[model samples]
Target chain A: SQQGEEDPQALSIQEGENATMNCSYKTSINNLQWYRQNSGRGLVHLILIRSNEREKHSGRLRVTLDTSKKSSSLLITASRAADTASYFCAVGTSYGKLTFGQGTILTVHP
Target chain B: GAGVSQSPSNKVTEKGKDVELRCDPISGHTALYWYRQSLGQGLEFLIYFQGNSAPDKSGLPSDRFSAERTGGSVSTLTIQRTQQEDSAVYLCASSQGFGGAEKLFFGSGTQLSVL
Candidate 1:
């Protein structure tokens, strides 16, 4: 079963705009990580935010986690055409398994 | 290899046929994971191996699916009597340690098509 659920199943924006994706999970987690998949192939690790920490950033990607609400969000600033891909949020539990959510497809038009 | 490597970037097999997918994780990495992603669907956890410890096979969907990691390095996932529902991209990933808090490096994955 999937642990996380991402909102806004699809998003379309113009270049230089910002895109935001949200995810909600069912249970407590040790950490949460975001990944990007291009062409429905391999997924690349984007950023990871521990349960103890509220936010993390990598390049233009920003991730925020809220344990109380059991949700997280990913924000891509100044989106580019290269940013078009499927974004997924995975929840890492105590058992060492990372369960992914139904990803949000973001399309950045140039 | 600098990153995880999977064999036969694409495979097409007939129903009831058996297929083996191989994954070679990065050198020195101890954790390996298998996941299945259907078209337009979230990834489904298949299995996980960490060092010499017993593998976690709770995520496997059926007895037809089995996997093994040899020498704590290369891993293979075998599916017997393939079904159309089994057609999906099988992804292999490896991490330096256990995955609860570590990032995983992924391979391009094998696109399996069962007819």
Candidate 2:
């Protein structure tokens, strides 16, 4: 089953602009992961932030997790047209299964 | 070799027909998972397998859906008597282990169309 919800279901931005997506969950998680999916393709793991870590960075991607608030956010800096796609946040709990959010659709206009 | 792979990129079958979708996970990965994503819907977990132990089949939707991982490697998801509502993308994901720190590597998925 799906674990959470993502706000601003769709966002449009121009190249070089920053894009931000938010996710909120109900249960405590060990970690949260961000993934990107291009049209008609599979998802690619972008970055992962553990519960102990409030924030993390990978290349142009920045992810922030707030355990107390039970929410997380993904920020893409200097967005490119190639970065246009759907972004999803998967929360990992003590259980082995990973529950995902509805995802945010990001469109970067060139 | 670096990512998960799936077969038949697309599959179209008539109602009441049975279809098999295959997934070849990353080499040496100990955990594999199956998920189904209907159009405009969040992915639904179908099943998961870890090593040689019993699979976690709690997420399967119905008796029509079943999966098996052979030799702890390649896996297959079979849907019997498929219905129009079953049309969706079947995704396969695998990880190094069943741990909170493990990140899943996903396959492109097979787009199934049941008519």
Candidate 3:
């Protein structure tokens, strides 16, 4: 069973606009990481937020984790057409396994 | 190699036949993972191998699916008696550490088509 579930199965936005994606998990996690897949080929690691951390930032990507709510969010500022892809949230447990969510398909119009 | 590598980028096999997919992880990485994704769907964890430790096979959908990591570097995923339902993209990933918090490097994946 998938541990995480992402909201907004699909989103369409214009370049230069900000895009936000949400993910909710069922059980406690040691950390949560986000990944992006392009052309259904390979996935690229985006950002990771440990259980003890509340927020993290990398370039235009900002990630937030709320352990109490068992949820996380990813925000992409000033999106570009190249930012279009499928974003997945993966929950990392103590067992050394990562469970991914259904993912959100983001389409940025140039 | 500079990154994870997978072979046979595309495969088309007849039902009931067996197929093997290979993954060569980044040098020195100790952890490897296999995942499957159907069209327009999220990835489904298939198996995991860390060092010499026994691989975690809990996520494998059935007895027909199996994987092995040799020399702690190259890995192979085999599916026996393939069925149409088994058609999907098989992805491989590797990490530098045993913990889930470690970031993973992925391969381009093998697109399996069970006819």
Name the runs in model 2 displaced over 4 angstroms: none
Candidate 2 structure quality by residue, lDDT tens digits, A1-110: 33868887999999999999999988878888988887746888899898899999998888998889988999999999999888888888766778777788999999
TM-score of 1: 0.98
Give lDDT tens digits, candidate 2, residues B74-111.
Answer: 99999999999999999999999774468999999999
| Regions of candidate 3 where Cα sits further than 4 Å from its true position | none
Among the numbered candidates, top lDDT falls to 3
Two-chain DockQ for each candidate model: 0.85, 0.63, 0.83
lDDT of 3 by residue, A1-110 (tens): 43789999999999999999999998878899999999999999999999999999999999999999989999999999999999999998887899889899999999
Compared with the true structure, what per-residue lDDT tens digits does model 1 show for residues A1-110? Answer: 43789999999999999999999998889899999999999999999899999999889989999999999999999999999999999999877888889899999999
Error of 3 at A40 (Å): 0.7
Give the alpha carbon lDDT tens digit for every residue of B47-112 in model 3.
999899999999999999999998898999999999999999999999998758698889999999
Error of 1 at A50 (Å): 0.4
Clashes of 3: 0
Model 2 lDDT, residue A99, Cα: 70
Ranking by lDDT: 3, 1, 2
Q: Of 1 and 3, which scores higher on lDDT? A: 3
Query: RMSD of candidate 3 to the true fold?
Result: 0.9
Clash count for each candidate, listed in order shown: 0, 0, 0
Per-prediction CA RMSD (Å): 0.9, 1.4, 0.9
